[model samples]
Target: MSQPIPNFYAVIPAGGVGSRLWPLSRADAPKFLHDLTGSGHSLLRDTWDRLEPLTGPDRIAVVTGRAHRAAVEEQLPDIADLNVFLESEPRDSAAAIGLAAAILHRREPDVIIGSFAADHVIRGTRVFEFAVRDAVEVAREGYVCTIGIAPSEPAVGFGYIKRGSELIVDGARDASLVERFVEKPDLETAKRYVADRDYLWNAGMFISRADVLLAEIEASNPSLHAGLIALAEAWDDRDLRGPAVDRIWPTLPKIAIDYVVAEPAAERGRLAVVPGHFDWDDVGDFASLAKLNSHGRKNDLAILGENARILSDAASGIVVSHTNRVISLIGVKDIVVVDTPDALLVTTSEHAQRVKGVVDALKLTGRSDVL
Candidate 1:
């Protein structure tokens, strides 16, 4: 029998300090807010638009650090004020999820939450919606459902989900019980995983009832779970959130949901994987931005050179300038050239991943202005 579509809520985690795409992606404006593709809408805006249909504006919640709250608000104005939860401090994904879960549980304990990152590009929206719908139904069945992208290559950048027995439902794509979750693997292991079709990329997208997630937290990390519950209990007392989060967030162990929840659940035979037919990119670094951009250019580029001759026909290169100053580039390839009013980044595509290293070096050298 076809399972009923469950009530859906979206929790977008937008608190990361996107250092890889630095110079362009700053502490004030993270990668999600940047126009990586020159597209007017930012990645976070795109993500919010994609989820609007599945989970209405009211049901959608964005959790971001206090620093990025204004940007998030500016990008997603339709979302109500109360729906945006601001983190007092910069906590990792685990704590971010816990914060959202606590807030949502206070409102609707049975709501099925779809936890996703703010900066991702999904190619097939229709397929994504369908997969999410199916995943929601699975979540309704009391299992934590996570959509797994079929491995396209041996990607060391992502975690892997091992598929077990098939759990087929009418009108839903065939999903498998997750046998185990593997962290970022080395090259050889990654290649082996791709060779074995049983593994899928862990996309960091999750679906589960609020109560179910709380229960899992209680079982897996009792201290964190207790903190979340305490926050939930005092949610109504406006002043409590500030002090409670300040006191608890620093002490909470830094961990990803995959490490804290999905892996353990998979070990206990409680995790499920719904196939994601949509093309997805996490855009973890500038390299990923290049891959997601126009064809031929596998490196992100911002061209601003007068008579700039771009022999390569890839969208990896981006050019941005508010002035009519003609910039030229001759025979330059796989580079990010930004003509900002104050700063500029001229680096090869291969070294784009090392941009964060540059940022760190700058910080160490006390060059806070560039940061």
Candidate 2:
């Protein structure tokens, strides 16, 4: 068994409401709280399981919204209460991760922090751990290291990372200097990027020293850095934390860590990329969800939950049922049917990415009951 890294800490940022997987994923119960992969554990739990072995429960922390605090605690009972950082309001990735970095740095000056999202599905556990170890090795050298996934297909939905010459860091032999970070591209651009073999999917996983991360944010955004520092200084003090967060969090700029730190760091030759060969899926939409759970089922049909009475005559798609009602499909192809207690969504796989539009429209119509 691989031993845990003494100073390597992990931070799981579980904030986003997965509107794309609506009906199944709600604001109150986001996608990370659901067992979308039929693993008998929530995605958040899976993430904890993935990192706990490396950091243990003590060194792992979760940064989430106040509403999710109870659920996150329930899922990760071993995580200390002090380790769960709750945000009073949504301040985006930069604030969420920066606060965690600042707090961790205050607690342990030489700590190495790796930020991973809570709702990603990864296979090849051994390979994933090895990549993280390599990233940690690079991180200790004062590099902003990111685990870049090898692109299996020309997926335009994810950002791409351009890798430059390899870094000759010990124990991190496969690490390379990150040349650039590109946003989601058109289909043609994605195809060309994949063909070049010089690009990797920006999986949004970063490893760096706590002080280095905070310093990078300070260099790029001093205001955000100051606010985060103020909050972190009072984070452990119960009486001061609440008041400080109330006064500072909302005022902090709402931006992603990519914009505030990673992208700019890449430009300034401060970023490094370690290729992850493990199979991974963010489960961004129902189509991706269907793909992940499409195993041991008859005729390309994927089923979730206790779908006891699912019958497909000439259909091939996925059905996520939370009810015991009989659901049958006759001649539909690549369809997605999500049946929840309060909401039922029926859309084809082709329109899975557009499900966010449905949630937006509902919000505009003042239908918060379903959302």
Candidate 3:
């Protein structure tokens, strides 16, 4: 219900094959482009919906692969073509987000930029906005800020942010200094993290002044910062932009934003976290996909795609059918069946995380057509 944050721009880094969701998610068409929630909307559109209220459509930008440009533009017709940055090839989060920061900073140095993922599903927009408002306030104070999700369960799939003392910032009462950024841990460590009030799930939501973000990047990784600056300088000139990207993008270091800035900033006491009370899910794997859609019940299951007939007896799993072929299940539990025109994936929810290995094996067999 609050007004949009002034001068706050949002950048969505929409890259990732989501190989764990193999067959259903491919290199050309990733999961972000799919309506995995069965809500009749792609995750990218949902993300735009969540951020549009905070920054408006004009202030939002998206960075994705060149191959998905048409699809991204089709889904987000409101987004201006200039706001969409296409990578010649993959360059990881550091380059994607850093390039965004560099260009936005070039346009408006005082701009507060927030980098969010495209594939996350979130509920409770009001809480989300409140947390983002707080993060913006923290960002205004010259601190690199991130919105950390309040952990609902002991999730080992996500990295954890340990909160230090509470930070005192106007409009950001719940803000806290980040103690450290911890990587994904074992089950026992994750359980302890859940029990401890100091830890929050790292949802990859970073907010900071565009200039400040670039300064941090310059301090940590000078070569990457230089490349981003070069590309950003040429961003406005249509003729030079393509040549700049083609030449500089491949030469930039391939590193994630976490390693490039978050962890190092946390160590220097420059990183802060605003705990988000909203329901958030990255939908990393099929098990998470089941949870998001509220599927995998003992008697009932989730069926995605139209004109797909399914019959089940004592079955508990999900079925995603792209074809009209009837799928039948008997006495099966936690199974995931994905039927496509070219490929079909049948695995249990228990073995869902290992689905990435399947993609790796397929790659070894030179099965690029299915992938």
lDDT of 3 at 133: 91
Order candidates by TM-score, high to low.
3, 2, 1
Residue lDDT tens for model 1, 216-288: 8788999888877777676667888778767766777677787677877788877888988778878776556
Residue 344 CA displacement from its true place in model 3, Å: 0.8
**Superior by lDDT: candidate 1 or candidate 3:** 3
RMSD of each: 3.7, 1.4, 1.2
- What lDDT would each prediction earn against the true structure? 0.77, 0.92, 0.91
lDDT score, candidate 2, position 152: 84
- Candidate 2's C-alpha runs over 4 A off are 295-299
lDDT of 1: 0.77
Task: Provide TM-scores for the models.
Answer: 0.88, 0.97, 0.97
The TM-score that candidate 3 achieves is: 0.97
Clashes of each: 18, 0, 0
